[model samples]
Target: MGLEPFSAEDPIFEDEDVLRDSHKPEDLLERDRELEEYQSALKPVIKGARPRNIFLYGQTGVGKTVATQLIMDRLQEDQEGYDNLYVRVVHVVCKNLNSSYQVAVKLVNEFRGPNNKVPTTGYPPDTIYEFLWEHLKDVDATHVLFVLDEVDAIGDDDDILYELPRANDNGNVPADETKVGVIGISNKFTFRDNLSARVKDSLCDEEIHFPPYDANQLRNILQQRAENAFVDGVLEDDIVPLAAAFAGQESGSARQALKLLFKAGDIARSRDLEKVKEEHVREAEPKIKESQVRNELESVPTQSHLTLYALLMLERQEDLPAKSSDIYEVYEIAAKRIDADVKTDRTIRDRLSQLKLKGFLDVDEHNEGPKGGSYYLYEFGDIRPDMVEEVLRDVDRLEDLFQKEITSY
Candidate 1:
């Protein structure tokens, strides 16, 4: 095989990672106001004083965590200049660590590093928390900052939130010397509201709400990103504004806007276009959605999606709504044909409900005759039957079943 040139000519991008959501720029374009407020919250850390616990709430793509990180970087830089103040920041995405014990284990592992990490499981909550406190003491950090991103994922098990902020004061660590601060960042307001009162009080000593960006704000964000992302004269005038408009109309997510820019550029590059244009962004939107749906379908458990497959077959093949009872009958046959275990009728119904909640299916409640109780008839919600069939065919055991029926419609 011939090696490609290291400096191949490219049109769409100067540096593509600039458009990635994970790529944090030196600063956000229009987040100066939020940054100032966030800076004030962390400024006390500069003087060797422990800052208040902070709860940051905002919709996705807003700059809650972004502003936090930028201020943290500033704080760290300032602390570096000081002789007495020392600061440590440990960031963990609590989505993957759902339980308090799991989060504590993650903290212990993060502090200890990979070679000496603890197991993800098998540790009791107390032991895990003790391990975390021990790591805190061992590091000798005068102040420890924990950024619990997507903290809603911790759900009802918010023991970590209740305890971590008070660890030093609670005698888990030496109270007089080191201070620990927790910053909880969440996209869901309901999750924050639903938190235990004790957890909320300790974790929300200071609260900030990051409102969704307006169209102009999103455009500014895209503009900052595009300054580094695309080469001059590559993107047409309408590209950034249109992407921002689309993202604004939906959720005003800067992440979505950035993703759109990346997707549009990617599409143009794949098609060997000279530059990214308005049409490229138009084409990229559906591709992004298709990819998202495929991923979401893949994440559903096989048994759960088996129930979905049954509904897909019923809804598409027979051109009818699928009742729980009818879906179970089809599901049992499909399960047996695929050499899989058939769940109980009740389990099948529960799976259907779960699939509905997952946005692949919709359920309509209906009352039959006076003697009959209400029943739910399932149909595709945001998902199409063809797409469901298409995605399910990716599973090896179900490949043949998703194909065209030999006997016709």
Candidate 2:
């Protein structure tokens, strides 16, 4: 058969960009309460007072970043009434930035412009802070807001969070020239709880919590995007509700809900179907979940992969909910079979703990009476054993192990 020709006209999508994460809607829907609290947090800026350091906490896809962008846009437009006030917002996504020094360098580079960018390393932490302060003075705005997205990635090195909020009081920048405030956005619920007392006091002056959207709310959000995303008659009546139910019951993430609808549309267009039906959305569910699992698996270390593989083997033999000691035994054999370095049992346990934290494993702790000790049992969490095996096979070193079926010692 000849190669299929490209379609002359597309029928499914009118404006596909509307469904994307980067697209910001003019108004946030179903977020009135959170938005009110958010507006109240920034009310000081309009009155020519220093802006409060705001902490926005929520699970992923609950509209934290989008809501912030919406408020910032409105704040800029309304500030026109005040002649003396100047407001500027600098956004930095710290997902890959791990230390206070790196985040400081990023801020300095943002203020210094592209041509004056600094290397990621080779600077002392104090010098970086000084440079940041110098650049803040140069901006010369009455109030400057730093929106640090995924601020939890900085981990224990939270000096940037503590310092930026106190830049004026600490004499880093003159109090009259530029007042700096930090707005930290984190998807990790424990990020705020893990902050040091001093950092919490300064950075979390005003906290706003965004709860996950329920089914009705997800349906409304999906319907709004669907109007702009697909051609008017392309979506069947039940499409939005089914997608919303899946996302609402599973994650309650607006982003996830939107993604499901987008994927279903693509599937319909692929089959050259006129309308998106229930089957299309049903098919899209597993594809989206598999993609999410693969992306997460790629982020972990190789040792973690071996640890998970060992669990997969035990699960296949109906031996799951196994203890760490039993897992270590299988893990050691798998490591040797692949000719990989064998980690000590303690180290293997650490890898197991890391995998558990990443949501790849479920763990239960058991304790004996007073004189006895405590131990934990492990099994796959949420993810299926076959899915874990499939993804692990993609790793070059683990490929041979799967082929040889060397699961037993």
- TM-score leader: 2
Expressed as tens digits, the lDDT of each residue in 1-409 for candidate 1 is: 9985576677878999887767878877777777777777876777777768889998777877777777788778878789977898998888766678888888888887668888987877788888888888878678999999988777778999999988866888784567788899988765787888998878888888888888899998899889898988889999999999888876677877788889999989877798898998898877766665676686565577778877776775774587788888777877877778888999887778777765778788899889998888888888777877777888776765656343322
Q: Which candidate is the best by lDDT?
A: 2
TM-score against truth, every candidate: 0.76, 0.84
Name the regions of candidate 2 deviating beyond 4 angstroms.
296-320, 325-359, 363-375, 385-409
Q: What are the lDDT scores of the predictions, listed in order?
A: 0.80, 0.88
Error of 1 at 23 (Å): 2.0
Query: What is candidate 2's CA lDDT for residue 149?
Result: 95
